[model samples]
Target: MPELKTPDSLETQSCQVILSVLYQLNLNHENNVAMSSERRQFILDCLQPSLRQRLISMITYSLNQDLNVTCKLLDYLFDSGIPHLDLITRRFSSFYFPADQVPTVYRLLSRGDPTSLEKLCIGIHLDHSEEGDWEDEEKETICWYSGVKRKEESVSKVLVYNSYFYPTLEKMKKLRHVVLHGVCDNQALSIIGQSCNLLQYLDITGSSDVTDVGIQNLVFPPAIQKAGRVNLVNTRARTNPSMKHICTVLARDTGVDVTGCIILLQFCPRQWI
Candidate 1:
């Protein structure tokens, strides 16, 4: 085995090893002694700052590979107090891990500083078609950050999965955009409306739980109202009798585009209007 060099040299050597391990793992070959050696070296290289940054960038870009490897590398980078951990978070705009792998990824993310984790746009996609016995997978994924405390006062954006919206909303105060799917009742929307004052765009499509009463309470403050777009597609508000009131408020509220107003009246009868 090669003796570890000086601290600086060790960092560089660790980076090289990590890079080599990643390259080899991506190859379509069987695992062997050589592969194992490369893997060990890669782990070592991750200890160096420069090498760690490079490795993090690679893993962030190549998340489709072994999720375990990428997550392990992330844990190492985070634990080492790497300065670029924020950068790594920014690079990870989406997560496409399998249902089984979500818990591991969530656990690792949960352990990191909330500010570090919030720097990235975390997205979890749930396919009802995907076969698995995972219990309440959506709740598990969303609740990962339940107890996390935000060091910073704000975050860029937060896009949540179907059922994960309620818990994650209060923590994200500086969000610029939010995309909500599935059913969210009046209370959920109200919670979001109150907490996220800086939100610019909101997409709540296919949400059957949002009613006109809920929509009525979602008032965009004057500042955000100046540059905000709300997309409410296939929602219960489409046919609700109270939609007229909702539309009237939106029309009176300057800065909101009324061109998409048809969505509100789509399911409502002509007589209702």
Candidate 2:
């Protein structure tokens, strides 16, 4: 049977309904998440592509807006069916998506559809708190969040230090365009060069940590680019919003470039593939 295109208002309503249900179910099982996962997947499966995209966009906005949504909620969405991102996320500020073994979590969720994603744009926060409340040595974990929320909302910031991003980046074999802002450290950049070998365009505008060393990895691909090997492990971690975060989310507020203020990026027949 052919699917009917959902109307604008109806699609918006559908997204609201799905979000409300997921939020409720998400709260019901804090400990045994699998139960909600099953239900969430059912919800994900029921929606048409249009409705699904709306829901994902709303969640992404809420996440970047410093709303009440928590890290656990993101996990439920992921554990359920790993919602297809309308955009690959250039404003992942708060780190509310689950932190430990994030690469692994990505691996598992994508098991159902590995090539579902292509482009990836990310911004990892690297600044410290202004108050200087705690000694650098004493502060083992910097908050991934914007720090505007209650202290309890924050999570450890070891993701960059451990540098487990490459595995996750590698998982999406068909990945092409890549964008890194703020957080892409040298190590992360180096691995991205190694893992996402088939990339067509890479933009690392604000990724202060990446220097010539990292850029070289992509520039000279033969030594690092694996011809066809596309496989990896998993990990997960989670955050929510602020100023540096604010600008990015706004730039990507809508799926369509309504204002014609931004340049669209696309990739074609892999010249290197």
On TM-score, the candidate that comes out on top is 2
* Stretches of candidate 1 exceeding 4 Å from the true structure: 1-54, 79-95, 116-119, 124-126, 130-273
Candidate 1 C-alpha lDDT tens digits along 118-168: 222232343434423445333322112122112122211221222344554
Error of 1 at 171 (Å): 5.1
For 144-257, candidate 2 gives per-residue lDDT tens digits of: 222122222233343343354445555555445555544454455455545554555555543433333443333334432344321111111111101101111211211112
TM-score of each candidate structure, all chains considered together:
0.37, 0.52
- Can you list the residue pairs that collide in candidate 1? 14-44, 14-45, 15-45, 17-42, 18-42
Per-residue lDDT of 134 in model 2: 54
Model 1, position 112: C-alpha lDDT score = 39
C-alpha displacement of 89 in model 2, angstroms?
A: 7.3
Candidate 1 is scored at a TM of 0.37
Off by over 4 Å in 2: 1-8, 48-50, 62-114, 128-162, 194-201, 205-208, 222-273
- Whole-model lDDT per candidate: 0.42, 0.41
